[model samples]
Target: MNASAKRLVFLLLPVLATGCARTAVEPAMSRPDFVRGEPRVTVHRDHDDLLSAGLGLAGLAGTPVPFADPAHPTAPELRRRAIQASWKGIADLGPLGGYGQAYGAVPAVPGREYQAFAWVPGARQPHRVLLQVPDGFDQAKRCLVVTASSGSRGIYGAIALAGAWGLPRGCAVAYTDKGAGSGFFDYADDSGVALDGRRARRGEAELEFTPPPLSAGAGVAVKHLHSGDNPEADWGRHVLQAARFGLAMLDRAYPEQAPFTPQNTHIIATGLSNGGGAVLQAAGLDDAHLLAGVVALEPNVQLAGQGRPFYDYATEAAIWLPCALTDASFDATPFARAPMTRGWPQRCASLHAQGLLTAATPAAQAAQAYEHLRAAGWTDNAMQVAATTTAFDLWRAITAGYASAYLRRDAAHMPCGFRYAGMKADGQPGVADTATRAAWWSDSAGIPPGNGIGLLGGTDASTDPTLAGERCLRALWDGDGADSRALRAGIDATAARLPRTDLPLWVVHGADDGLLPTAFTSEPYVAWLRAEGRRPLYWKVPHAQHFDAFLPLPGFGERHLPLLPYGYAALDRLWAHLYEGAPWPTQSSTPKGQPRGARSLTPAMLGLGAN
Candidate 1:
């Protein structure tokens, strides 16, 4: 039989089936007729359009419908009018998954032009919309906006997990290509040519548990990468565009829907590493209606201030640039020393001549050097002086280049899985020694440098002679002082305007985090928040390196099963708070109790930190 005839025959065969069997086939094709026991909304979709329809249907069922727009009106009137319009729109778009029709892509940015896909399970086709929010309504809700760095390959494991968790809790997720057609995974692509005049260099191998490339219809991708080489501006624009897109999407989907409305919605911005930095910048700049909270994992805040010439000194001079120091006991005077007045080489000679090395023996100096290198690699020698230089004459001349290089590569590299032998967790003849005791110091002592302790001693406000000098010089040269000031002012202003203590925040960090030391980052932040009367939840997972806590089951190497129990439980608490408006949970006050790793951090602590 011909193809058409055979398809017809197959269709008839289902109808001809026994009574119970026939009923199943009928309901599968025809528009759902909600019977007494049927779902309020039944999702049905073809394979190609399933995800979009599924998400839209979920949004409809979970919240109130939206209203339509009205003519020109006052600010309050516009908001009320929009709310009504959104409700009506949703009501009219009722029970979305009946017809065989698929939802089309939506436009998220009007003038900019972008397409978006919304999915709800069981929908017959995808609901696609083109987003273009009205000029005044650029910051609406119901949008799923994403921002990433230029080289960011797209959403990966932990980030994807966050999206999955947020979807069920009332989020419509979307991402920007950041102008790089390839998502975050593009870095793995091989482009180098081979010497044989044939393709030999392959794309770098994929990282473990990396997410797959997204289909054209799955989400929207915007081309916003600029032509200039300004990474900061590029990043700032990426964030702003993401926020704008999110607002436009919200307007299109929910129109006038409340809670999801621009002013009422609780927008939570989060990202990892560079993406995390984008979220912070976006939130800091436009916290109104766009960002309610921020979760920046391994964010690079240091780069934000690198424009200052004072901070650029270290990068200018190659001193202490290659070592990885992490000792907590060493004094800070040596590391923070600047180049001598006479000259770099002359300074070294003078220090050698003075025999100042005898005062702080090589062993003691090694301990200090090792500590800084272990945590943050090497400090730029120039920046070190600007940050903490005490005696430019004596300390600057003492060139510790040999010790720095030895500890940086040979000694420090071995302990944390490198081949070289160094310190071990138990102070054994291995690299792991540093990892073990480092957590204790971070948890018990506020960051060493800031607290005026350990290797960073004398660098604090009291001892550092160049502290004021550096600050004044940096402020004088900062061209973007206005932008920096605006960001700080925005944060402060937002804190004052939205002084609601009801929102609970939680923070989670791995004790052995190498990239951003927990001791210097989150731990200190949490302490400040607490001192300010905000009971922030803080959890320090031992042995759990940064990003490890968020890994999926059969982790990167399948070495340890990812512990998502804490994350899961924290979500439950969050849902309760969001839906029932329950009282927020308190911060964990108990001392260290659990063993190192994800499980060591409890749900309570996670929830606390999330606040």
Candidate 2:
């Protein structure tokens, strides 16, 4: 980023800012109000109503209003219990890597403390596990809950969730690092358990690995899915092993204190995204009833075998993404909107000259483009940056289209980025480009966790990629090539293969989920469950984006999105039903507290306009 990048930003920021400037109220649905469709489900405000009352996405400023009954256990009481819990051994667990690019260092939870433990499946070196237990946590009343780390920042995901939700509930919680989040494992390494933690140039940083104080023998090889590369096992073997080990440790260490017994105490696997999928995989694969239930929050496709399927690597890399890049508008028909007009022509030309993009016919061009890009210099880093840019452009277009359709705003409110922001700038909103100033790079180099690279994992796109990619979808819909078969097999392998059991499973998705769309992530699993007659519970929250329930809303600074409170309540109900024979909680309310009931999920039912 030289003078040209600055000039480009100046020219583009105004246009991009236009997308955020339109203040008109758009219809919550994707379609027009006049369109006849299923009745929108009404949601009830049970235990999570306070979230909408000024809690920001970070939930930093305000104390969470006490949602629990005075008689029932409260978060504050549970937190107090956690604070007083015993701390026998503390070790240097080392640092979890930061998210790449513009995202800042992963924040440390105030109460979370790392414990030395050798549990993860693969490794020559020991891995530490983070554990927190409620003060009154007992085996008879409270079950040990193991959460999976979702993003590549490894343990950061665990820290965030545990601090925000789990530990507050007074239950025992634990998580181990999934190697993939840190980009530690080498795909090219053939020794099976090969991992390189040495720091290197821009795209390659040495991962930190501190062994547990006590040797747990040579660690097992983390499975493919957990690595977050090649999508092998849904949550990966490392997560599964770590989860099981966490449970076993809970049973052994807290047996007298709580129902941490293997046969009696219930263990639940829970998490978001990859962690969510890992729980599902654990439930399916653990034949010994290691985990009694699963609460999967918008799991990745590899875990559930759901969503709009991709065939080959080429399809995922090429046509699927390029279609969105070419979209001129965000209408239902996804017509090529502005590839040539926006900036793809010039960008593609530059890439072509650099041997990154080649001239090819329109037939199955995605694969061709992928080959060229890979042949040139597109590593995981480059591809992630490109994907983030494409996703942002597409989300803006879609948001503008919905606004224009319902609020009378023009769709072209923003200009796309001129160059791949690359390692210089993360796609996260508000991050400054370090490439523009060498001093800026040096200034951020000493930051924590990732030294400045925050939790901007690949899946955590600055914008959504669920919608576009029609060309790739259409092309691969009936695909039957060797690559397709291999890809499908890999996906299928990651899913739970054991016969469906009595273990309970619950899934929740926000209609306005911006990170991963319900149609692509959860719908397929819901359909499969229905077909299998598994009787799993699923909820779709209207006007709720990806972070609404889990993360505070960034747009509305201090106001919480509130969906997660409901999700937590639902989890409680699910737990009670499974463990205590209590009936499942059933109540619904709209964002306005209007009474409502669950309805079939449809494109119209989804709150596309809310994002």
Candidate 3:
């Protein structure tokens, strides 16, 4: 059958290839309906390839690759720099961090990368989907590993985790941003990120995002914050579309190996953090019976009405965690910067004024706040580790990004008086420079107070600068306003919607994960799954927590192990169970898996002897 005719056949009769066989008999080449336009395909060879964009393990470990011209970066330059930034953002590539020696590295896999924009059925915004098919892909024994970006990062966000493992194995790697990416729309410049990762004027190119117009100087618009899509609710659908796109592209890549469908190809979905949550959501929403298995690492998930929603706890932490961190016991928790933390005293005094704390001194108030945080479901270890995330202003940034998403609000009318602007040298909000605006697509992490985009407004005068906005955000959850109700409904919709499927599911979470506390997320969610008659494996690592990027900091490596190694091991076990019929590791039966104590990570840490 011809390519166009076969694509139509599959599009019209969706299930025509449900039982597609090894021997193709009129192959059902399904062309994904969500793919918006023709893919911009590029072949990478020699100095450039799938895993690292030509920068080898050593180069990726160093400084970020810079563009030849800041104002005009080509698709290849943006792609290269983004890949490097993503690697450093997600994994610990420090010399002693065990990337090349223990778990993963930039594997030299020559391949062709296909990039395209995919739209949800009725959504105006488009999320990016990229597929990498290595030259060594085994057509007969087909495999595809798919993932969504972990946090508010660009499309390359999870490449360090997924592509590093899959590409070397000759499996195609499918990635999607899941509606959260660094597609910044600078209202001041009247420009936005184009499909090729360049800054372009409104009508110059097909922009990745074009938020509601601002009144001349209201700053930039972040896709995650201003898309008005309630994207988290549709993360599962985005991932499913990513997989569908990968499958169709795979068919197109190798016409000789035609009829490659979900029924015939072994598809495994994996991701970390928000991406982790995305994969689990995909597992739940696999009503089409597409996914063969899922492996989620430190996933941000809540069982329907069972666990604390991210919005609830994240907003809570933004208000109280820093107040709690002033306690003496939190003196040194890896990466906490003392200068930035000095404002905690004023924050405590402000909370006291608001009747949130009733103590005589700031220290005493901090103790009270810590106790309050414990009451709100934070464990001692988790709160101690929360110092790292808190110091980086993670709680506030995450809440700001998600609040807009939940309310389906635009940048022009953000909730709680929040807005984004470029920061000048004097630390004031203004129009960012031409160079900074040009690099937004590759530099920003899809959140404000970063990459020249400063978060502004909410309170003109406050001792604690970000406190007022945080309080306003908390009030949204605590209040019964129409906007709050709408946001609440959106937050509630993020809970995994699942049907009964005993597909090979593996969940690996750090027991000491302070940001998404294991007690509030994985423990309860796993129990809920088992009660639903599905047996999913769960691994709770003792000395691990979120953010491997923190490992190179003073006490971090000594106290924690990287979750990437364990996550990689889980994928190994899942593949074995699927292809070799190997039994699921016995460690996961109990939520508390093998505990390698607070020491340096050894190769044996994953229970898989040396690499």
Candidate 4:
């Protein structure tokens, strides 16, 4: 099909599908018949107590401890036997442009027997499926499918929270391996290289450089040691495939429970960082089954263009334009030029004309731009630049890869790019113009950093050395393009569909988030959603970086300004929205605690301590 035709089909398909699949209730109506009552049993207090330990624990456990017995039956064994019995019933099928494949089961859902396969593009082997059947499944009122993130599989803590806690009362739960079985990273050894006619095996290094601040020599060492072209590509695919497979498995598993209809099955998908991205992508594309809602704790969708580049507006513009203008050994010009629009240069020039260029030195400024492009795996050599001026010569000695390495380091420290003043040389305002500050504060204030999350400082099971290796392997194997675009589009589309309102979206971010900025957390999307009449309940926790919220640590202090207590309160209010389906009480309340009934708050009212 022609480009226009393809675009038309793409746009029409979702609308048509959306119309046909429209829920019985209005999309905006939050009320549901299944309101959860106060817990009949005490909620699992700490992460460790939720799931039975041992291989039974699938996914990241919070703190290190002995393995517990399986709380649920060994349905995984039964499922394996079932798959073996009806192997011919399943077929591998590709979807979303062959980015991944789906295993189809005969009769889809509500079938007694299940058939499914896991497909990831570059993995040497497809992920194996493991299933767990909750106790008294035949007696349960509902069924749930929990999808886990990397390191989450095989870890007792994460599984318990997701499977035990996340599942509504009277529901049976099942989860997948997420391609990381045994709670450890897989090690690949090369058998081809040999000495004295004997095969020699060497353990491949799987851990990529930890999020930045690399020693001065670390970059060179990494370049020489690391084999994967893009770290994200390495692990992203497995996670995507595993997630997709998990959903398919759910389709089969859903049939066994009491309330087996599609409408009644509650499919709540969630994940942290990579897994979070998977949740967003899956939600945007698939509406089948019981995909009730999505909760992405800390997703990593690239959000650039918020700051200025290192080169002056004219020079960078020329470099980012239609030809190669930079002399950098690595041809990043093309990659840099793509994705960036002409408007970026224009905006930069406008800012420069207004004296915003004096904010930071060329090196620091260039570092920010370089980091953004590099993370996306695009280099200056990829851009088409012209050699009109001596500008390209300056960048010649500075390799795109080298620049990218430096930028990655910087990104690890502050993924959002430094605040305007922070990016400046003398702490003088560069991009901190009122407009910039407004944008920054607008995005920052809504998503508070998560505090005391265990994923940081290597305490969380998700960050277990063994799990990290598995994650690295997954990243190395999965191609990155499909997941990235899917996440971006999903967020944008979700934002577009929301009703306009100023209600905050309670967002949690790890203070150590290395991928996207904390602002990228549903805040901007929520803000955009508010513009469409939707109210978001936004909040953040300190030291809770991406993925950390999913992996809580014990006794770590809150790392942000408002700290943990305030963070929990914010979460409580958000939970009200999710459970009670009521607009935040504060949303319509005046400063004096008087009800205002959906009226937007005034600056004075918000500024006042009341309400």
Candidate 5:
């Protein structure tokens, strides 16, 4: 399979593979005829064609889906258009009808009831849901755990991951489409669809769940939600709504399958990366009273050291290049002018005197400059100043060129979040919240002035030095609404500040997560839980990056990443304790069944100060 095919598959399903073998296989029952059911979901059969292969692991074991034109619709595009057109005709059933209805079920390896539907009623485009109900489901006893996918991915990705943990244990899983921000997941291929302007070139999976999206189209563009990066939609609310909708749809579809009603069902939420954050937010939503617990895998949240002018100075410098790269319309005016650039010379001089800022080119120069600053005996402001000039070009090369496969992958996987914009509440073209503007960015470089780089020669009106003329200079450093109280209500809701019930919370984070580091999310979350006397279990994956927890490794044969499966184990323990009166295990072992190691969050982790 090529990279494009792989990316398409990524959009449709979870990126992680199952660690456990199938324990049960019920006989395939009569498949539900979705065409006759309520217009909730559109079920597609698994076939050898690229469309079916993109959604499910069917044929095309080693066969690659040949690419035609980069402009026209490929297999994934056709499917997306079909879904959108179908969504236009869906009758408004109000809140209950919005989630649509389940058509039929396909038995996957027996015992598992896999059903696909187009829930989420009022969306501009039709979002999809892939639900799996294990054989012999009892809502009164066993609980259902819905999942959220990362970035602009659909619920299929989460469904795939849930297959590893939940489905094996008679747990039902519902994965929702995140709007129009995902690609298709192809197991046979590697090269999948690329970003087509704002919309996905292939898959119209769930869009990014950002602060702007959750505002329910307050100041953001509704059309942009299905297209371009930075749709300015509040995705947190979308996730929560979709989750509630999914549960409702499931109840309507399989009322007799389980006795647990939406009100009485013990529904928990879990996700990885952005989805992880969404689940956390979902668990915190006011309507999430039924949500029992949350298992956040590398959730996107703030950290103490992540705040600017406090800690993690050197590490902040590393973010500049990626930030600039993702912002297609990035401007170099602010860094080229005074005040912001005034200290560059002195900082460069001090750094050079201390043996920093080596090469003159973009990549080399930026690396050399950051390396020296990272070493020792360097002021925080100095390194930040020196990184201004070359970081932009360096970031450009990274997005375009092929130095690290992960870098290219990260760039490709980025959602429609970052566009050069302002922070005003006005319904303008380039006005958005800090979180939406900084999370997912384009690699293009057509940054409109005053949006990305700030005003050319003006003083910042806000007291925060990072906010220059409405342009947030510290966007990448202080991403996801750092220091902003605008979305406090949403933030608090997602953070679950007011616990709905005493459901045992568990957070398993990868210490080496490149994107959403554990220091900012799980570390502080665990501390908050401890303070609240919730006694949350916080587990760490040592030397593992974010993607590493999902994808397979070359040498270790999947055994190297023992920390990944611990999340499932934790869930098992929770289920057993909640349902079967089993004692919850205080700690979980790595995938290899070994005792996991521990690490503490420190300033040095973000390159702020010495450990």
Candidate 6:
């Protein structure tokens, strides 16, 4: 940045802080470069609010808003359900889970929302960006938060995480789907999700994603899995564009604050999961001093010298984690019910037949599998807790999509004969029902095995159907084939080298996070950054794991801590450091015991000062 950029931190408060007031003269602000065409602007007011889609905290905690018609739902209905679903997916929102009382409160904030398609210069399809500027936004604070979707979710993916934290603070929030969204394309009907959240024909309106032409009965296509963009490589740039979009949209909404530039605004980049990875990526690319600080929690990150890559570990889990989970000790984990774990022995059997497990009995094989995983950096907590993600078949579902994404393959060319679609009674790939299709925009997590879309492979359980595909995925990661080379290349592209910077930086991780293990992501990430001379505060919370929503089971909840409260606290800590120069704690919490039952969580349990 030039002297002009660095000198404006204290120069524009009087002229640019009055949000939403029109100016007599036209502003010199220009639209962000990646933004394509005109954006669809919606002004939320009176009854409808930005934070909860008018549902407030109480409404969000209750049942979802019913769609008048299941076959063809309205856009507003989709938006409301999307908000509720996004919230429930990220946090433990039940009364006992400490949603309303412990940390978060949903207040009504009328705001203007901007939704538009943003093109990555050489991408096949455009990613989506959304900007929400509350009517009561304090421009003098000049705070803006930009985040990416946590999983391969839609634009509202991080609403429950970053948006929940920032919007309540009167800060403008910018979100991007990061080229991975809940846009499903059904080849049979030639229909897809439109920009407005409606189901439309391929050429109707502006479709969010249109799969390459497929055979008549081909499966459903997801943007993240089938876009052929390998989008993770561009996650950082997507966040930067989202930040720019937020600033530009702020100028449009509050012309009195025209020309909202990075210099004058305190831009804070933050997120969770993949969204967390996105913010970290953006920080590395912020050579212009654009971002003032960053907070990433349990981010699925892979740095030059960090732990194992997501694809490598995910596929590894998909293959052997099942056999390991068959150990009787894991039966108490979340989703590890009898019906769910009944097939674990079968997976172990398959592993045994393939000579992967040398034990003769399933019990012995399971123990051997456990020992194998233990030697491969699988923590004791992660192995036990991962029973949840494994039972959900998330490992296979996640890896198949990532394999396709990392290889930049189209739907027709997905590896290991893996694909996604609704399943028939007989378990064959079939078209999704009208009711299922109607709710996809609001329900799908931008991944299959969700929103009624199932992964189509050889055969589920009884046959250890996903094993072959998972093995194929791992082969691509370890073999010497062309596909293997291509897959590794894409993973390399997503690698980060977050350089040392003076910006306020913080990273928090759940010590028991099984999905993106702490061993593979944050510990080494913080260590690498420190070695490079960056003094980022690192917090590793014990008793906490990824996926707070999955803590419904008594054993899971009792044994684990929710990750949200800590993340929110870190954000507060960052805010105070930015404004009050408060001391930032560099040490981990002293492993506190949590009051995890319903209505049991409190500020003291979280180690925050007091309520």
> What lDDT does each candidate get?
0.29, 0.36, 0.79, 0.28, 0.38, 0.79
**Which runs of model 5 end up more than 4 angstroms from their true locations?**
1-38, 42-142, 183-236, 257-264, 286-288, 303-498, 549-563, 585-611
lDDT per residue as tens, model 6, 310-423: 888888898888888878887666556636667778889999888898999989998999999999899889987788778667787788888989888877778988877776
- Model 2 lDDT per residue over 530-554, tens place: 6776666776655444432122111
lDDT of 3 by residue, 232-280 (tens): 8889999999998898888878888866788889998999999999998
Candidate 3 lowest-lDDT run of ten: 12-21
Each candidate: how many clashes? 92, 31, 1, 79, 57, 2
The per-residue C-alpha lDDT of model 3 at residue 66 equals 71
For model 1, residues 1-611, the per-residue Cα lDDT tens digits are 24432222111110000111110111211111211121111112221111222223334223322222211122222212222222121111223221112211111111211233222233211111122222223233333434442122221112232433444334544343232211111112212111111112233421111222433221111111111122233343445455444554444444445224335555555554444445544544563435554444544333222221112232212222211121223225233322332133222332234452222443444343334343443333322222222222212111111112112222112111212112333533322222222121111111111111111111224322322232332232233665334333322221111113434555555454433445445555556556656665655554344333222211211221112233334445555564468766685442232322333323233232433
TM-scores of the candidates are 0.39, 0.50, 0.92, 0.37, 0.51, 0.92
Q: Which stretches of candidate 6 lie above 4 Å from their native place?
A: 1-29, 424-428, 458-462, 583-599
* Candidate 6: 10-residue stretch with minimal lDDT: 9-18
Query: For every candidate structure, what is the RMSD over all alpha carbons to the true structure, in angstroms?
Result: 22.3, 18.6, 9.0, 21.7, 15.2, 8.5
Please give the range of 10 consecutive residues that has the lowest summed lDDT in model 2.
Answer: 85-94
TM-score: model 4 vs. ground truth: 0.37
Q: How many backbone clashes does candidate 2 have?
A: 31
Q: What's the CA error at residue 361 for candidate 5, in Å?
A: 14
List, residue by residue over 43-118, the lDDT tens digit for candidate 5: 2223211112222322111222322332333433333232221111111111111111211111232232232433
Candidate 5 accuracy as TM-score: 0.51
lDDT against true structure, model 3:
0.79
